[model samples]
Each structure stands twice: as C-alpha cells, then as structure tokens.
Target: MNRPPSNILGKGWLYCTVFLTGAAVMVIELLGTRLIAPFYGASLYVWTSLISVTLIALALGYYWGGVWADRARSGLSLIIAIAGLLTIIIPWLTGPVLLATDPLGLRLGSFVSTLILFSPSLIMLGMVGPFAVKLSTATLAKVGASTGSIYAVSTVGSVIGTLFLGFYLFPVVGSREIFIGLGIALLLLAIIVAYIEHRHLKSAATTIPTALLVVIGIGLYPQIANSNRAESNESFQTRFERESLYGWVRVIDKPKENIRLLTVDASTIGAASISHGENLLAYQKIVTLLPALAPEMKRALLIGQGAGHMAMTLKDYGIVTDTLEIDPAVAEASIKFFGFVPTGKTIIGDARYEIRQLKGPYDLIILDVFTGGSEPTHLLTVEALAQLRDLLTNQGILALNFVSFLDNGQNATLASVAKTLAQVFPHQQVFIADPDTDFNDFIFLATNHAMNLNDESFPDSHRTWLKQRLVNIDQSQGMTLTDNLSALERLQIRKSEHYRRMIIDLVGTNHFIR
Candidate 1:
C-alpha cells in the first residue's frame, strides 16, 4: 500500500479536476431551469424538482463512488469521461425528454424531466469528489488533511461557478454553447487523468474522438434547434426569440389569427393585433381602462412593460407612461417587434428595488408583473404595497392585474393580494375579464379616495363591459401576504397547472420544449 506514481498529472491535476467538476455541477443545475422553463415554466415546481434531483443524484453518487473507490483505485478517468459525454448529449436529449414528460403534467412532468435530463451527468459529477479524495491521498496519516483540502477547493470552484455563470455567462452565451464548453472542459480533465494514470499515448488518444464529436455537435446545433422549432410550430412563426436574465423571451406571429404574442417562458404576457397595431389581449384591454377611473390623471407608472401595450394605451389618453421592466430583452423585443415607445422613463430592474428610487407622484401605478404565470411574491407583500401607495397622487389609482380562479377555495393568492392591498389603500374594487369562468384575469383597482366609476368623464366604449366584470373580493378568506409571511408559490400551484395547459392548447406542446 504505497501512493500511486504520477507523471502527467500528479496530485495537482487531481485537485484541478475536482475544482472543474464542482463548477460543472452548479452550472448544470442553474442551466436546468432555463432548459425546462419553456415547456414547464420556471415555477416553484420546476425549481423544487431540479434542486431535489441534484441533491438526490449527489447522494447516490457519493455512496456508489465511495464503494467503487474502495474496491478499485482506478476508473476515475472513465467516470469523468462518461460524465463529460452525458453533459455533451444533454442538449440533444432535452426535447425528447420534455416531450415524453409533458403528459405527466407540471409537478410530475418537471420532476421526471429534470431527473432524466440531468441526473446521470450530475451523479457522475458527484462521483468525482470521493474518487479524487481517494486518489490524492498518499497514506492513512494524510487522509484527513487531503479530504479537507480537496472539498475546500471544490466548494470554492462551485462559488465562482455560480457567480460567473449567473452574472456573466447567461447574459452573453447561449445555453447550448455553455453546455458544450462545460463538456469540453470535463473531457480535457478526463484526458489528463487518463494519460497520467496509464502513462501511455493510447489512454489520452481514446478521449480525443469524444472531444471531436462534441465539436461536431456544437457546429450542428443551430441546424438541429431550427429544425426542431420549425417542425414543431407549423401554425405560427417566431419573429424574435432570445434568452435573457429573466427567462426565454419570444415574439410569435400567427398569420391566420393576425396576432403577435409576447411570451416570457410559458406565459403569454402580452399580445397585439398585427394588422391594427392595437393590443389584442382581453386583460390588457381592461387594464388599460384605468384612466377612465381618474379623468385628470396626467402621469402613470407601469411596473411590468410587456410589449409596451399598456404604456401605449396610457399614452393614447395623453398620460406620460413610465415603465419598469425587469428584463432588458423583453424591453428590446417590445420596441423592435411590437413598436413600443415609452413616453416617459423606461427603467429596467426589479420592481422592489426600482420602486424606491422613483420620485413618483404618479397619477396611476399599474402593477401587471407576471413571470411564467406567477407574480414575484416579494412585490405582492403588504410592505411593498405601502411603498406603491406613497407614490400615488391623492386621487390616484393602483391597478393590479392578477390571474386566478374566482372561486373562494382556489383563490388564495388572489384573496391574499386583495387583502394586502386593503392594508395600504382604504378603497378597492375588483374586476374580471370574464365573470362566467372560474379562471380569469382579476384586475384590482385600489385608491386612497373614492373611485368615481360612474363619472361622465369615463368613455362609453369600455364603460359597459367594465361595470359588468366588476366583482367584490372577500379579503377575510386568506391571511394577508406580508414581507415576513408569504407563500404565493404554494397558493398558486393549481392556477399554474391550468395556465400551462392553456398555453399548450394555444401554442402547441412543441413550442414549449424549445
């Protein structure tokens, strides 16, 4: 029992391999959300599935890797090489995995899809740590120090990986390219280990084919992706599509229907009549009628600028519309594809942070923020509502576009939001896109003073429909959502499922997988 002789790699290369694998694990985990988001959405269920699967895979890998390492102190290179291969094939496997799991529904589909697409590579990656520790250790005396140093290096790599990938890589690099880059890095590591351990040209030469295959895959990816998208979506065509810090931003056109849709992940945030250049969405139409409530309203603050439809509507009423949108890509798409021009300041950042900086005495503040059919829970809190209330003029109105079921049993998120708004603004009125359906867009109009909906200043066109959809919300049902206490994700599970099914019906299942 002596230490294994090393020529090519030594202990230093072993540590480097561990660091790279650790980074690979995190990059894969983060990228999983982006891949699955188009089909299943970036919901609580999707995140839960990915995180749980990563941990479960790691646990299994650690146990099996330890057992295997004890029996044979070789094959670390084979394990790394296999993991690299699996990582390389993930993009290829993604569409099939998503299609197969679509029938399972949101919760189960997301879990199963994540398990199928990522678990193998993640499990293989997890094995690297234990094997590296065993290979690097010279004797029983140095085992503890070796284990500590190895894991410390791995953790440091994971930290840097998370920061770099989330901040720089995602914004600039395509997910496919990033995946290919990671696979290439891992393959190189495996080759180094193989050459070091076997001390022969053949050992390193075996991994070269796999490296070339990955290069070929990267070159052919654009064709594969375009073919898939075209084959899947026959009815509509994509005008613009790109990945942003927020989610997948796509502008789709339906020639038959003559409508262009602005979609973020699985949710259709906004839609416009292609020939007319007017908003086509029922929710947007109703939400834009906020100026009817306050005739003299001169300025408005829109929290979510989806295709700039609402901003455009407000501007039509001679109101200066300042838009706050989190995703820059969405803003760009709005301007380029939908012809959205902001009359006022166009601030691009999270609503929670940006809301504070605004020197707003806004006449109307429209909060229409929705991501993948779920609102950011932080912005729905009572504390957040109060900040918005401070910005409103004395006779100003706050119009919140919420999508949920009308039934009391299934309206936890809606009720909680209504209750939260009540804590800040004394007067409130709720309206729905369609009162007959249980699931509809619920627009909550809150004001510091009385809402004069009966005023003669209100237009006759939308007045009749607005009065018909007006409904009362019983805030007593669910506890108010506060900064300290909010479980909007759990509350919106049923709504998310319904939303996903509707999207599939509207756009077809193929549009989601890509």
Candidate 2:
C-alpha cells in the first residue's frame, strides 16, 4: 500500500475532519425528517424512506471514497468540502423541491423528496470514513490502528450530534439556521484542511468568496421561505409555529371568525372560537356528552390533550379530569393560544406508558391521540384496547375519536377499531358526527354493559344527533387491529392523501413555508 507524502495534513486535523463530517451526516439525516414532516407526515413509510436512502447513500459513498482515495490522494479534502457545501445547499432547496413534488401524493412524494434532498449529501459525508482511514495510515503495520481510531472518533461525533441536536439545538434554533451553520462550519473545516496540506493561498482565496456567498444565501433564506408561504391561502394567518418532539405544532388564526386552531403537522387537532367560550369543534362537543350517557360521571381520564378543548369541556361538566399530553410544548401552546387553563392535573408523557401506570376505574376514558393526521397505531391494537377496558368502570364508556369515511364499504379504520373494541367490550356503538359527508369524524362508544341511549340525562339535541348518526357495523366484514398485524396506518393512506389535499385546498399549497 503506497502512503501519501508525509507532508499531508496532521493526523489530528484529519481525525477532526472525520469527526465533523460524521456529525454533519447525522444532523442532516435528523433534519430531513423535520423538513418533510409538515408535508408528508413523519409516518412509518416516510421514516423508512429517509433511513433507507441515507444508509444506501452512505454505502455508495464508502465505496467511491475508497476508490478515489487510492487513485487521487490530494482530493480528499476537496471531496469533504464539496459534501459540506452540498449539505448546506439542501435546506435552501428543500422548500422548492417539496412544492414541485406536492402533486406526487404522500408515499411517492415523500420517497422522492428524501431521495432528492438527502441522498447526495449523505453519500458525500460517508466518504469521510474511508478517506480518513487512508490518509491517517502511515504504514502497513499501523493500518488497523489508524482505521479503528478514525471510526471510533467518527462514532463518538455521531452520538454527540444526535443527542445535542435532538435535545438542545433543534428546540432553540430554526431548522434552516441549524443547517446553514453546520454548512458554514464544515466549509471552514474543509478550507483549513486544504490550507494545512498544501500551504496554498489560493485555497483561502477560493474559500473567502464561497463563504461570503453562503452568508448571503443565509440572509436571503427568510425571504425565500416567506415567499413559499405566500402560496398558502391568505384567509388564515399562522399565529405561532414550533417544531416539538412530537411533531410540528402550529396555532393558526382565522381573524374573521375569531377562531384559533391547533394543528399538528398538517392535521387540525383542536380548535376554539373566541366568540364561543365552549368547544367549537363538533367532535369535541360530542366527546363531552359522554358523561351524559353514563350513569355516574365523577372522574374522567382524557388522553391526548390537544389544545385542551375536551379536557376543559369535561371539567365544565363537573367532571374532575386528569389530562395526559405527550408533548409539553403542545400543552403550553394550548394554554397560551387556545384558552386552555390548567385546571386539571396534566401529565407530560406518552399515553401508552402513562395509562399503564395510572390506577383508574373512571367513568369515561377518551382516546384522541393523533400526530400528523394518523393515530399512533400502537394505541389502537387489541392489547391496548384490553388495557383500556380494565381501566373503565363496569358500566363506564370508552369513547374514541377517529377520522375516516363512514360510507359502509369505505371505512376500514373505523370498522377495524370497532371490531377491536367489541373484542374487549360487550357492546360498541358508532356515531358519525356528520353522517352526510363522505369523510368525517366517526366516534366509537364502547362499554362492558349495554349502553342506554334513551338515558334522559343526555341533552335532547345530543340524543337526536346520536340517533340520526348511529352506525350499525356488521363485525363479519371488519378485521381487528392487532399489535402484530395492525393495518390502521396502511388502511388510512387514502385519508392521509385526502388530508394532504385538504390542507393544500385550505392553505392553497401543501408545503410548510415557516
């Protein structure tokens, strides 16, 4: 094995370059999810595409990098620098690419978007490992040591990048800014390595103009992102937007109606009209009426407190409600923008884990957890329903809110959930909040004992609505959603597509501008 001239950059500098490039690769991978989440949702398919593309790109880069390292020893720094520059450019290009691909629908569009924006940069970053190994090995005897040292350093960098970006940097800075900063840092490192190796003034001269151009581009990003937002409908103004651990949370305001809506990713989770003090969403109002259906209603467990609309309604009805929300930012935004006062005890954690820890024989338990228009399928499995059944009182009702088509043959998610509930509870009743529509809210009410729909405790209007919208599901045609064989996410692909289109229609575009 022929080694390059001993005058090449110091081993320390080479190791540092490998570490930084490794960190950048992971950062870009994580940010890619955030980039496409607002449009396609961070679904299983979306994640699978992103991860698979990244690994494939890295594999290709390793092969190409090793070949290049042997053929052209001096070009390693240039390769790393080029990769860094490309990574920087990706964030800027993402908005346009998403807009252009909006017509492709979710599955195909998400795959294409990740492939276009993430693959090239990742492939380049992957080259750092083999390139570093080649440059650091001084002799045949030291090759093993050199390779292990470089890989260990690179892995450490990946761990730091993952933890820091996820826990700190992502929450404090905008995703666009983070990408720009990472790019600038990587570019500077590349320039430094080139100057160290060759003592070339021309490398510095070339880097100055490129750095300035990157800065200028960073300055223009806000305007470009804003222009992208101009494609959305101007009817509603976005009052607040934040990327949380759960997903993208936005509080949109309809000034004319005095309505403030809380949307997670592209799906509207909760809404409240300032003019009406109570809940304005029809589904929310329906859930609140659960106490009326049950004989006793003292304590209630409300899972997934999006904007706290249902929790507030339950509290107003004299039920001591305990709310559980996975994302703390959501609960904070709910109180700040959506008039959610923290009257009840709010627990911040995953509902599945928290539900198991809680000791409950409550009158009502409402499951309304949805992120990016899809429910966490794990929470809808047969085992989950059985756990929920154990928490309910003997005559207590378990109410679930699901969005699906209710036209008999078109409602797989709804029917599957109903069938699963029947397996645990003796009686299950389905109510379509808007029976006339093709796609609407389908509320499922389940209980161990038969529910008395004729209970005069319910308001006459609610009773009338329930009678009109009740769906008689034939269990023979539906499949139970189990932990091992849950198809809720797959079955709801059409609804997810519809959600994308509906958002595009509502906002006049499917992409997230901010």
Candidate 3:
C-alpha cells in the first residue's frame, strides 16, 4: 500500500489551522459571558447556560464533522470559513436576541439567548478538529500520531487564547470589540486556508468584501443600539461607562431624581443623590449607623467602596476611613463622579487578602463587598470573619451590609452568616433596613463588647426604626458559613432573580438592553 503522501502542506500549515480554530473556541466561550452579562448579569445561571451550550454544540459538531470528513475531505476549508463568518455574525445579533428574550426571566432568557447566538458558531468551530485529523492523516498506520499531534496543537492554542483574552484583551478592549476582533481573525484564517488547500482565488476574493461589510456592521450596531435605548427612556442617561476586569461598570445619572447610580454587571451597587450628596439607597444610609453604635469611631476600615458614599459619610464625622476596593476602576469612578475623597487611604486589592496584611486594630470595620448582586462567598466564610475579627481593636465593631429575605425558609443564608459572625464575635446585633419588607438589607453588627443602640450618637430619626428591626439575639442560630460549606451563591441567586423581575416590571424590557 502506498504511504498516502508524507505531508499535507510541506511545512506545518495544518497544525497552525488547528491551533487558530482552538483559540477561536475559547475566545467565544470567555467573551460570551461579558456579552450577555449586561442583560442577564454574570451569575451562576448565566455561566451555566454558556458552558452547557458550548459543550452540547461541540458534541454535536464532532459527530457531524466525522461523518462529513468521510464524504468530503476537500470541504474542510469551506466549513471552517463559514463557521468563522457565523462567529462574526453572533455579536451583531446579541442585542436583538437579548431584547426579545428579556421577559423570559434570567434562567430561561439566558439559556435561550445563548442557544440562539452562540451555538451555531461553536458547533461549526468544533467540526474543525475532526476534519483536521482526517485531512492530516497520511495512512491508517499514522492515524494515532496524527490525531495526537492535532489535538496537542489545538490544546496549546486553547491555553494561549484563554490567557491572552482573559488577561490582556478583555482588560484593554470592550467585550463587543473583542468579539469583533476574534471574528475578524478567524475569517482571515479561513481565507488563508482556503487559498492554500484549493488555490481558490475566486472564493477568497468574494470573502474579503463580505468580511469588510461585517466589521462595518459591528461598528455601527452599538451606536444604533445606544440611540434606540436612549429614545426608549429619556429620563435615564448613562453618564459614564467602561469595561473593567470584574465586569461592565456604568455610572448612570437620573436627572429627574438628581441621583447618580453605580452599577456593576447590571446590579445597582451604589447610588448618591445630587441634591443631598449622600447615598440614596436605604441600605447604604443604614451603614452610617455603625459609628453611633460603637463606643469609639476614630479609625474605620471599609471592605467595599461602592461609589464611596458610605466612606465619605464616615469621613464627615471626623473618622479616618480606609477603603479597600477590589476594582480600581470602581474606586476611580467613585472619586471622580460620586464625591469619594481619600480622607484616610484607598487600598486597591481583594478585601479578604488585604485584610490579613493590614496593620489594623481599627475601631470600626464595615463589610459591603458584592459581585453580580451578591456578596462574594469567600469573604463571608467563618475563616474570613475570624481574620477580620483579629484586625479589630478590643472595642471595635464589625458591621456587614447584605441583602436577604427573612421569610422562614428564605432566611437560611441570613441566619448562617449571622451565626458565623457570632462564632467570631461574642456580642452581636441584627438590624433590618426595613422591618416591613422581607427582601432588604440585613445589617449585622458584631463586637467583643456589647453594643448600645441607645447611645447618644445614634441618629435621632433612625433610632426607633433600628431598634424595632433588631432580631432577637436567640434567633441567630443556624449552620455557620465555613469556607467549605458556604451557600451564599445559591441564596443570592434567589434575590437576584427577584430583583430582575422587579426591574422588568417597573421599566419594561428595554431597561436591560443597554
């Protein structure tokens, strides 16, 4: 038997094609999250949908590609080229697809949107692997070597893609631009491969103009979409917007209400009214009560600086406030737009990690970190709480601002977190921002010393309200949130879903599209 031709292209072109296709696959997966996050939020449900869709698409593509390889070896380039083109089209379609499905709820809406926008491109790209193996193999004897070599090359490409996109591309460029760049890269690769395999000048020539048109369309889509969103709601205006390592950050100004809102991944993290120049959110205002409850308030540490409203408020009371904010972009925006001044210091890093390295025996420590509408589970663990406790002075107080529902079964996370805090601090007090509402801020104040709610420093108006909402000290019993057993993510999802529904009802679906 003839050794089917020792080489496909003289020098390693097949490997390069496989490598590029691999890179494209990972790019789609990573950037897909950012693309949908603004509409559905970057929650467990959104991530789960994106991953599940990619796997299912790849599985179907592998099967179909194998069958196609048996029938037409020459069609590999055409298949990949078409897939690249389709990938380009996906980003363009994202806005419309999300708008159409916004009413379906986060879980179902995200799943349907992922299926419609991402599956086709991923399936097509998945076909490249099996097809590459078929084309590269010279004979039955070398099948194993060919398969292994192609896969190894593809795997290496995936690693490069993940690292480059995550570390470099995402931080520098916006999500929509990243998608556009990936699509352009893939389309160019497809044209090159087609020319190499079939010497098809005619096909490549046609593809060039089509690629140009696609890029132009992508550039125009965002502007048009923004205009449409603005026309939909004249009262709400996006004052500032930027892509950050964590997610999309936006500062929206509601001129009618004289409020400026800070949002990360569609969750309202902070809001300050222009008229009062203070945090408009009820939960944030409640954090100010900490200084009144604690015995001493000279030095304070804030774990999260959402627009720095709470920190600024503390500064006004003559306390030295040091804020630790994870996202530098958020910290910068807070100062520039939200009246956050560096009254004491602004540390940029993770709250949990920074807390351990701090030289602190602070009089007050406030925990307000959140991501995608929920507290990060890592920061709520028993071990983390213990570390924070050690950073406080003997008379210091730790106040946590979190959102949870207090209706029996829905209060598991609230109970667990309070239990964990109690384990670290002997004396603890619970205050719900609103006693009438089940879903609202649940502030937990813990200290080694007993807290006096009747202290003269307490705000006169809030004294009675805070006293009324204090949970019975005996009721703070439940499973503690140790590092290993934290269920904050699951609990937060329930509240996030509720928030999504409320927003949709109040503003209509267009509120989410931008």
Candidate 4:
C-alpha cells in the first residue's frame, strides 16, 4: 500500500477524492441501515444481511470494473457522470423504496427487509469504486496504484461518514432528509468531477433508457414525503411518522387512556391514554393490587422502557425512577403516543452501556431488557447482575420480567435466571402472572429488605389480585440460567460463527429461544 507511484492527482486532490468517496460509502452503508431500520427491526440479522449484500455487490463491482476499466480507462468524465447519476437517483428513490419496504418488511421480517430495502442502493454504492479507478487510470503500469489510491479515498470517506452519522446527523436532522441530502451531494460531486477532467459527455447508445432512469429516480423523491403520512387506521387525529437511526416512531392521537408506543421491531410498549378526555400524568402500574408490592419503595430505574411503561408505572407507585433505553425512536414514541412524561434524565444510549455509565445509587431497578425470545444475553450474565447490585442501595431491589408459556407451563430460561438471581440476592421472591391468564409470566422481586408477600404495604388492588392466587414453586422441571450455567444443559445450544449465525440462532435451531 505504501509503495510509491508516479502519482497524478497529487497529495491534495488524491487525498480529497479518497476521503470524499470513502465518506460516501460509509454514509450509504451506515445511513442505509438507518434508512431501512426505521421500517424493519434494527436487529443484528438485519445489519448482517445489509452488510453482506453490500460487500457482495462491491466484490462484483470490483471484478466487473477491473475488466471494464481496461477499455473505459480514460474517462474521468464518465466516472463522475455515473456517480452524479447515482447522487440524483439515490435522493429521488429514497421515499419510494422506504415506503415500499414497510409492508414488505412486515411480511418478510427484518432479515428480508434488509435485502429488499437496501440491496439495490447498496449495489449502486458498490459500483462507485471501479469507475473511479477506471477514470483515474493513467497508465497500464499504474493500474494498481490508481485503484489503491481511490480505494484509500473511499475508505477514509467511510470513516468520516460513520462518525458523522452516529454523533450528529441522526440526533439532529431527520433520517429521510439526511438520505436526500447525501444523494444531492453525490450528484453534484459527479458533475464537478466530470467538468474538472475537461471531457465531453460520452455518447451512450441507449439514451432513452438513461432518460427513463433519471425520470424514475426523480419520481422516487416524493415517496419520502408521502411515506410518512398517517396512521394505518386512517385516523385524522394521528400526527407524526418520524424516522431515526433505530427505527420509525409514529404517533396516533385518540380518545384513549394512554398514547401507544410501537416499536417497528416488536410489540407495543405503552399507550398515552386520556382520562375523561383529559391527559392524565399519573402512571398506571396499579401496583397496589399486590399486597407484597409497596409504593414507597426505594429509588428505582427501568431498563428497556418502551414509552415509559415501567418507569411511569413505578412512578405511579411513588418510586423515584430512572430509565435506560437503547432507541431514541422509542423515547419519542413514548411522548408522542403514550401520556408517560420523562424528566429528560432518561439515558439515550444502549441500555446496558448507559447503565454502566450512570452514577447509580438506586434502590430499585426494573429489568425488562428481554425482547421475548431475543433477550440480551449480556444482561443475564452474573457480571451484569453484580453491576446492578453495585448500583443498588442496601435495601435496593431488582424487578425482572420472565416469560412463560401457557401450555403445561414450564420455563427453562426463567428457572435459569432465577438461579442466577438467587446467587446475587439472598432476599428474593417471585410473583407469577395468573396461570390461566394465558401468559405464564413472573416478576421476580430481589432486594435486601424482607419483602412480605402478605404485607399491609401492598396496594388494595394488588392485594386483591394476590389474595386470589396461590404461590406454587415448580422445583421439578427448570434450569437456573446464569453466567456459569453452560448452554449444553438446555435443549438448544449456540454454535454461531458471526452476526449472521447469531441471528439464525435467534430464530431457533433447537435453540431454546427460537
């Protein structure tokens, strides 16, 4: 890579082009995920598929362009012209493709969404390199040098793109606008590159096809504006559809008790409902139903808050709550759909990361990180439990949600998790959801304080619910999953090789969660 050559673009222009192209690639790749993720779940599988398709397309472009460059070697003008086309087309197509991706995302799931939504744009992105090298090629002997330099530029561009998108672009401007902006930038660069080379336009035999393509691209722009129009139910009261780095957040206003928070990837989190047509600020936990559950409980934190469900619920119970959630889209959705109001102190980074970052002296923390079968493995580890413990005051408690099936009701994962919790906290008790209520779910209360299942501290409603149910422990069929608990004990085991493999595992191949 360091081998010197008879450089043509020189240190200045060459470096500039490399950074620009590299930035474009990174923008397209990373931002493309943002573009698609708004419609689909921003799961690792989705990322794997998108990145895979892009890499494959790039390899094909490399091969084809390497061969084509031999003949098309002297046309910097042609290269720029095509790049320009890409710029225009990409912006124009943004709305259509993303809109087209919605129902398609639903039908195909996140995996297919990645392919259907991003493949074409990624392919277009893939073709940029070969043409750049072909246009810049000075001599047959310098082919390697030309290609290397262009690629170096493209990579640097990518690094810039990544930093820009992650830190500023996503947090500030909307995702749709960013897509359009990048497209325009690419188009201008292409035209500029062509003129800088002082070359006339190439005579294309198929001008009509080219014209049609441009027209089609121009038509795609409006799709961006229209893709975000209204609620699926056609309710006039619904207001917004915003896209973020994580996914889309839509707000629907109805004469209801709470605003509904919907994650593009999962089920609804919470609803912003109205009381007597007036918005109520009260949290709806109704924790008073369980005699054992207390309102004046110590400091509290909620992980994986969707529209501030647990946070608001706990807040209703008079517990000081802190929330940590990964997606900003979800946070926005909470304000837009659910009546839950957060006090701006809610952490916006990845939940686990933010939890580690916080200066915690919390008395209670709610663990709802499990996205059903796709629970975060790291959070279930002993180390994570220990960290949570570290943040807890002496009497602090952790409320964990464990899912269970209604049929014959046996949960290996919950048992395993319980085993781990027992290791962490000696004073722990479990409150299971009604067995016949369809979900064999349980909420494990872990704290240093002696919690009384029959304590007078329970709210009247919670006490009534607890009074009707009997506490039964299934010591027979279960595994307490902990950091030390090996996967072999479960019926399913993971042998994943990469992100793609892990996704497949999430879908279950004799794996317990699938």
Best by TM-score: 1
Q: How does candidate 4 score on lDDT?
A: 0.55
- What is the Cα root-mean-square deviation between model 2 and the actual structure? 3.2
- For model 4, where is the 10-residue window of minimal lDDT? 505-514
Best by lDDT: 1
Q: TM-score for model 2?
A: 0.90
TM per candidate comes to 0.93, 0.90, 0.90, 0.73
The list of candidate 2 runs beyond 4 A from truth reads: 1-10, 140-145, 200-234, 455-460
How high is the CA lDDT of each candidate model? 0.82, 0.77, 0.76, 0.55
Displacement of residue 200 (Cα, Å) in model 1 is 8.8
Report residue 160 deviation for candidate 1 (angstroms): 1.6
Q: What C-alpha root-mean-square deviation, in Å, does candidate 1 show against the real structure?
A: 2.9
**TM-score of candidate 3 versus the correct structure, residues matched by position:** 0.90
Estimate, for each residue in 310-356, the C-alpha lDDT of model 2 and write its tens digit: 77777777888888888887888888887787666789998779889
Residue-wise C-alpha lDDT for candidate 4, range 1-514, written one tens digit per residue = 3222224444454456557756766676676666544333454555676777668766775676566646653343344334435544443454455455434433244445455544554555556677666656657888888788878777877877889888988778865567666665655554455444432233343243434444554566676445433224422244555565555555544433234324333323444444322223122232333213544465677887766756655555566677787777777767655655874367887755777787878867778755332345667766788889888877677777655433343445455666677777887766656645534446677777686656665566666665454334453455555555534112221111122233323222111010
Per-residue accuracy of model 1 over 411-435 as CA lDDT, tens digit each: 6677788888888989998888776
